[model samples]
Target chain A: MAASGEEVRNMQVILKDYVAGFPKESDMNVKTGSIKLKLAEDESSDSAVLVKNLYLSCDPYMRGRMTNSPVDDPDFSPFTPGSPIVGHGVAENLRNSSKFTLLMCPFPYYTGILGMPGMTAYFGFYQVCSPKKGERVYISAASGAVGQLVGQFAKLMGCYVVGSAGSKEKVELLKSKFGFDDAFNYKEEHDLVAALKRYFPEGIDIYFENVGGKMLDAVLLNMRFHGRIAACGMISQYNLQQPEGIQNITTVVFKRIRLEGFIIFDYFDQYPKFLDFVLPYIREGKIVYVEDITEGLERGPSALIGLFSGRNVGKQVVKVTNE
Target chain B: MAASGEEVRNMQVILKDYVAGFPKESDMNVKTGSIKLKLAEDESSDSAVLVKNLYLSCDPYMRGRMTNSPVDDPDFSPFTPGSPIVGHGVAENLRNSSKFTLLMCPFPYYTGILGMPGMTAYFGFYQVCSPKKGERVYISAASGAVGQLVGQFAKLMGCYVVGSAGSKEKVELLKSKFGFDDAFNYKEEHDLVAALKRYFPEGIDIYFENVGGKMLDAVLLNMRFHGRIAACGMISQYNLQQPEGIQNITTVVFKRIRLEGFIIFDYFDQYPKFLDFVLPYIREGKIVYVEDITEGLERGPSALIGLFSGRNVGKQVVKVTNE
Candidate 1:
């Protein structure tokens, strides 16, 4: 294999078959392959992002993609077996469609906050919740990539924001760096509902639903009339064979809550708008981002597994290459 | 009872006690009650409608009010155990607050199609659903008071509307009188989902939800993307100790269906607009309203109980008095 210039090998991790239950690291195997730097000779389409795949995002929804059932599936096209699973990544554009063979100048995993997690925090909060100033906002998984941005955005919008995280360190990050009005470690809290009541005596007006199941049930009972719930992901229920049953959906009727689920791809038109809003905040240091980068593509499997186990501190990403 | 100028005794059906599970005919006992002709002959601040109860509407929502725990219930306010139960009615203003009570006249049963039920059909459809012309609209309980009005409104909006009722007679009324594009007897149809698919090949754009449970599950399956479901009532599940388990709620995420429950009292400002829109239709012969009037206050228990079993056709109403 030639290491430099036009003739370079592309190594990819391919799924051997469809998954059942939580995916294991052994379910996927890395295969060594070569590309001629052009889709005409190697890949299928010129429109594709030809990247030296770096940090692949491991989200709970990926579990749904691994299943083969046609019934009750999300709108996302199902993942094909024995194919390289594609996801949000920070990567180097190794070759251009314009040239027969293009050389790479890489800052691997350098795509800005406009990536999947960023757009998720942006549109999921603003558009789905339609939050107004001074409205009380509550977020779960507060120190993660999406949660951190959501808290910051809520603060920017002049809202009273509270967050619940997994650890004390994450709780502090939420309160200090993210400027959350209040933060709690959900792990330590004995009664989740009482904790919410203590923080918000008046009640929550908007809930960013990152974790579903019992937390959702508690949130439902506590939600004020006309409250909105942006159901971004249900992390707590993703790995289970049977999702946690919710007993309080009737509250949606009584409270007049608008609970809607959304995918970022459905709102791609807002990407430019999202970039405009978040970029300035990033440059001025008004918005701070934390990424837990695990080096090398071979190590991507463990990093992904870390997401489900809550082992990563911030954004869990893998850096494939550096040039 | 002492009479003034035209003061006739007002007869009412008072709730004997709070109901347990499904209410029977013996649950409520009719009682005679009298209101003073002129506000309290001495005091001055009473300007409410002194209606001569003509046709008292029996609705499924009233069952919610009959429970002692209604205050804790989200859908309705609780009924006083020993007081008169309030509902929609078609009545004459027997004693206008500005005028003295006439000795020959008495206020009628304050329940019928024109009272709360009319407003329920009005705002619940137009405002909550925000229906557009030529859209496909589906309404359940089509021959009932609210359903009848909803079907007519959809027809007026140039929509292709279909309605489902329990009996064949109600189905005919939906087609002939209510002007629905099609009507089906859900009790006779083995496959509701298949029936809906046959009726709406393109899928339903708007669903005015009156009867929930299984029909709601079926509607969810056939709803178009971004479809709107105005959840006015879940009549089918009202009497059950626990609401039926739904298997297809996840469809709300895929189809982007907005299923919202609403109360008419929340949008009271639209009352004048409702009258303005409906009155012309009533006079022009474009609209038709059917009422099932049962005579005597003693029969109120049976009339109200009939609503749960789908025994009454058109609007099930009790005729309390003729002044």
Candidate 2:
């Protein structure tokens, strides 16, 4: 069995080792591996479609996959120690007769709003939140990929929406660009629980929990009776050695609150419906999608790690190739 | 206005002050106060109904009511420091023409298994857990009023259920009486997370969270993908000045677990449906109802305080009168 193909240098971001605390750029290595653009007759199979990777999504959830997962589920399993990182990415099928094609993908946008993150915001908010016309909604990590979309969705539903971000710029983006009723810099707040009370005098009806720990505890304190929490992501706890305990958790019973956690994979079957709804929102400028993109695959580690520290303004993406 | 009906001795348990940590028996002052058995001749209102207290339900949620609650909601508002404690009670209508009538009388059982705790277990398990046959279930505080019924419900559903209690007796009762697949004394297990893993090697599909804090943190790690948690109460945290931070809360995201908190007050409308479901089980002896009943209302302080430390064997009830 002779390997016969046109060999090309494929640049890759390989996981150097399993991460412990916060992931640093040093934990990943930029490696150039040779791969055949076209498969030989001997190796060609009906299912094997070799592709050229264009863009990679750098999400906070990737932090979990960086660690050696105990469970063997493919969706949540860890990245191999010395392999090209596996994530939500946009790829161009190298084979001319390829069946694998992303639908109406403008590659970068596909990594954010029009991709997995888009469906996440779609079902996580509408289905999980069960939003009413005049409900109050508070989104943590509001400038990020999912939060921004959720905020916009809440606004479209005539909700009083408030979002919190770590930085001043992201906070501004939430209000000015994403159409949040109001936005606050979480970093500036001394007492987060009290801060939420000030913001929600009547109390929050829906809490889009993105940053967990103190924020979640605070949100628990501020949530109104019969409030709904879509437990989407907990970026704050991802890198921590010890995750924070929720004090006001009992308030859930007192208030009859529903805190539901969901993954986008489970709801992927409904992606077509989400696209039907969101594509129009994007085309008509009803929703704003922002991306903080890094130019090269080599910068993937930094871009992905930046999400933990609130360095990425919106959806973090690594542009592997333009081809 | 002159007080008219025959005045009788109303032995009452009053909160001495707002509690800080674990409540003491001294915090509740047993006072012999005089109360009219009937509405005064001058104060007969069309809506008002006078009743003689028969039995009192001493539940864990009362710990929250002992503290001064910020929210003004009557269902959860704190008891006045010097007033008789407000809680679920079985009362006989002094006026023969009273509309507020108990559908079925047996007062002691009505205070527990047939009343609020019964409804809590019924809806909390059936509605919130979304249980399926042969699914794995775990319940913390499994020998208590609500937990006991929930375990029985799980067994009836043909699910493999494990329960944890603070006492060896309760553990025995869980396995022998309530028909739990397995039971453990959580106090004996130094490592609750490892204990849970040992019991649930495959992982938990449903977690009935009664004692929160460290127990909840452990349950999070043990939850199978798409697990549902009915956050009934956090009796453990109610005594603590600082609630223990849940370290594995991020597992809620990884496992896509749903942690829902509810009160029986919201589900009162569903009581008729619950009665239809559970009354048959109780009558057939398919379910066991345990009660650690105090002889008199004077002993209410000790019995109520006993719940926090897992002192009550089952439903802690104060038999105010046999009348």
Candidate 3:
């Protein structure tokens, strides 16, 4: 560690160029640059805090940042070519007194269960779905970060929970590890609509949508009357230049379905309440969280890209640097 | 009019065949059928009430019934080819003490303003949209039964309302008659998304979706953060075997939008409350309902088909027999 006001070598994962379709590892490069360490005078200092990024979140939403068009939120703006990529990350203030105190859970898990993804699962399921006991629930990308948690939450509510994942292992994880009532490998299913019909003969009452496109179309076709769909993310669609159209959208009207999309940024106020609800679940071993971690900042691009192809088993995170 | 236990000739609109694409007048034929008129001992009697049909409603949803595939609800099941077409109609008990009392509004208006259409507008705008005062609202198929009421409801809440219709006459009606803040002819605009952007420069806060397909795709792009879409009906998509896909649905996630589809049948219990709310509005001239009344039962096919082609100016109703 460099002393205060001393010149030091800093490492960052830089976006080499703007991405068009599926992002490759060549799109980013790990580079070392010089930085001068400085301590801020007060807690609310105007100057930037020199933070040692402990963990970097590899989320699918980051794919929008890699594109040419800027996202609406300035915080999630387009990643400039030849500049550092930005996303949710766990960082400790190295200049002075550290600011973070994640007492309830391990700091590393902040990139997965204890962070934005956690809040997303909590609110998206409870608030948006308005889930009732004994209701049928289905989750797409079932073994992933948000999907797994939602499936568990549905199970907790006495719901008949079914999930779909791309790989056999993820499907098994959803059933055995996450306690989903039934799980299937979406890749193996030739007819998704028929598959859903088989799993949910009564029809799905609530669908936690993650992978949008054909999956969404199938889910729409299988939804029961007065069904609710909580749309959190669409990883499969992120890399596409022109997203595939959802053909069975008319079913939403006929079946009287409610499809609601929510961003975690809007529900940050509920974080404290979410922590109160989920902390006990985590402590009691009721809610189990899985993660796929990659070491070093250099692997950030590949880790994030893995999300599009369903390469990541769970929450994908990169360990930037040790405290 | 027929007396008790009397055999009489009944004029009826019969479905000649199941419809495939857009419904034509040839799909239905006016026929005269024989019926035995009778009266029940009590109001709750199991025997059917022999009544003279006064008015028959011509709604776009009726198109679904004309298809070979039976809709989910048994009440809205597929129309049997070569059988009498069934729909909402204003009738009076001709064989006994007349079971009819519409003191607040005209009995004929029950086919449109004072009944299902009014209730659809009430719940869809207030409950589904959760509209606030001064929010921007947009309505597609704005000159129709439900759309016109939704527009007026938004205006009553002090919202800035814009409407889109298929004709120049309807555009003028939306602005001058229905009191929409701004109105446009969607058929004139080659680029719907750009047209919506022009009208809703600040982005649409509420979208009362009636016409679906590409229009819904355009509305999806122009919605504001935390926008609400009350999907009452999708008139444009019902005729197609394969409904057009909805692209740009991902904006719902980034913008935290809520899109809810509702059936008026689900809100039937709220009729008395709806009457209390809308009756005053009608009496005070705050809410004006327009009707396009066709004179004879034989014209039912043409009147009903006109809804799909946007040939009718307002709520299309066929006066079956004068009360």
Candidate 4:
């Protein structure tokens, strides 16, 4: 029980209060707490896994957890006033110290292609959209974590994929790195519906909805007959006090479209199947992932808040520890 | 060839102009045109079926056809100015005159339980919803054509069914005639979400969405986890220049709900199977239909317009001819 070089500083990001509108870095605080690295005497529970946090994912869905809204899901909960923010992370199992060396992989890989966003991309595209070969696929927030993977997956399926990103650099990354057939800076496009119509002249067969709000409204107007919308996340609407109205929803009826909302947690049962499907592509270098790593948990607040402002070019990861 | 004494006055309801807001009787004109009962010499094409129109269905979907908005469907077309308004009709085949007697059933039966609305109810409930026994089912516009059948079908499935309608008479019809577990007059209730919560304390498992706008918004807030919303029609929004904004749509994500929009025309191939499934119920008096029939084709304009105002109590039908 004596302090014998086992004590380590665990930096934690805590929520200051329930957020309103866009979240600010001031809404969260980074605190340091000491923890013993060794396993406790009563750590015999097989169900319990002690993990040393390495890489933490900053997802758009995290914004929802920061709000006081009563809408609850098994996948996520609202952030408590003075509690440590919890999300998907890549960690080292401290209980099985010897096994940690065997499980070690690139940290960025765990945060991107081998993580929650990767599973989300796999299920949202294949399971929800059911994209057929030669089908047209459009993805919003295309340079972001899930979006980038979805666009690549669509291309792998022999689909003609187009993506919309916020910045020019992200747009270039979507086209050059992610292998998207076409990419555009949505911020530059004043008329989103017209831009969609331009990209998908025959109309979009599958839409991987990530941005939501105006993008969704525009996409609704441009959807093809029997189109499928995989509503994985609505990043643009997450921080808004009042989500924008989708006026062209009647088009769903006319086109006989299917708009399904899903959480990645529901599809975790297929993680192994997804890994088997995706690992070959990753190993062969057919699928590439981009990561924007912000070192240290002290930068967690700014890194997490940066997602709302499109500051992160790719999968935003906060590196808590090298272990 | 000598002219046979087979000429009859073919009374038709013609669209005067593209309707804007709520349809007025003045938007349509009842016109008389003469037609010969005998098929022309060149009408031997196997694809073409000439029939004598009997009962014309005055459905809420027809309101969409009256608008000039260019949202086109293979099932329906916009009403042209100074042209006969075309829609789903119960008719007797003139080409197969000998088989007419065999097909002759109650006109109201064809308009209600054997026509488009019947198929809509069947597919929207069974296919889209996939209601399990003991599930909670909620139907909006509950005493109308599709709603009544959906309620009865849900009852037959051993599910607890609740319905919402515009008037007390319609609410009574839902409970008494259609055997809904509970019925409410939505017009009387100021807060739809609260009313739905009161009726479905555990939340709705299946929602047969007939009315859109506020009702749908309210239903979104009260849906159970993995709830199915069969978007058959949005009668309330058809006539509005600006449909009401659905603010609680994010609830679809939280609840892991499926909202699918479909046209009955797609399910026409399953008609024989549907007839086999439903005819026995009709014969056993397990299923009943209510029709608000307007006598003569001249009253078609009034009957069609009455749908927008919630004036027609049940399935609005214009009885054009008896034989």
Q: Which candidate wins on DockQ?
A: 3
Ranked candidates (TM-score, high to low)? 3, 4, 2, 1
lDDT tens digits, residue span A216-273, model 2? 9888888888899999999888877766766677777778888888889898888789
* CAPRI-style docking class of model 4 based on DockQ: medium
Candidate 4 pairs with clashing backbones: none
Model 1 chain A poorest ten-residue lDDT run: A100-109
For B1-323, candidate 2 gives per-residue lDDT tens digits of: 22346677778788889999999999989989787655544456755556778789999988888988567578878889998888988876665544345544356788788989999999999998999999999999999999999999999999999999988899999999889999999999999989999999999999998988889888888889989999889888898887777677777776788888988888898778988887777767788899998988889899999998888999999988754
What order do you get sorting by lDDT, best first? 3, 2, 4, 1
Please report, in order, the local distance difference test score of every candidate based on alpha carbons.
0.76, 0.86, 0.88, 0.85
Off by over 4 Å in 2: A1-4, A38-48, A97-105, B1-4, B36-49, B97-105
lDDT, candidate 3, at A40: 66
TM-score of chain B of each: 0.86, 0.93, 0.95, 0.93
- Alpha-carbon runs more than 4 Å astray in model 3: A40-49, A95-101, B40-48, B96-101
Task: Give the DockQ (C-alpha) for candidate 4.
Answer: 0.69
Model number with the top TM-score: 3
Q: For candidate 4, write residues B163-198 as lDDT tens digits.
A: 999888888888888889999999889999899999
> In candidate 4 chain A, where is summed lDDT lowest over 10 consecutive residues?
A96-105
Indicate the docking level reached by candidate 3: high
- Cα-based TM-score, every candidate: 0.85, 0.93, 0.96, 0.95
Candidate number achieving the greatest lDDT relative to the actual structure: 3
Writing each residue's lDDT as its tens digit, candidate 1 over B188-244 gives 888889999999988999999888878888898898877888878878777777766
After superposition, candidate 4 runs with Cα above 4 Å error: A1-6, A36-50, A71-74, A95-104, B1-6, B36-38, B42-50, B94-99, B102-104
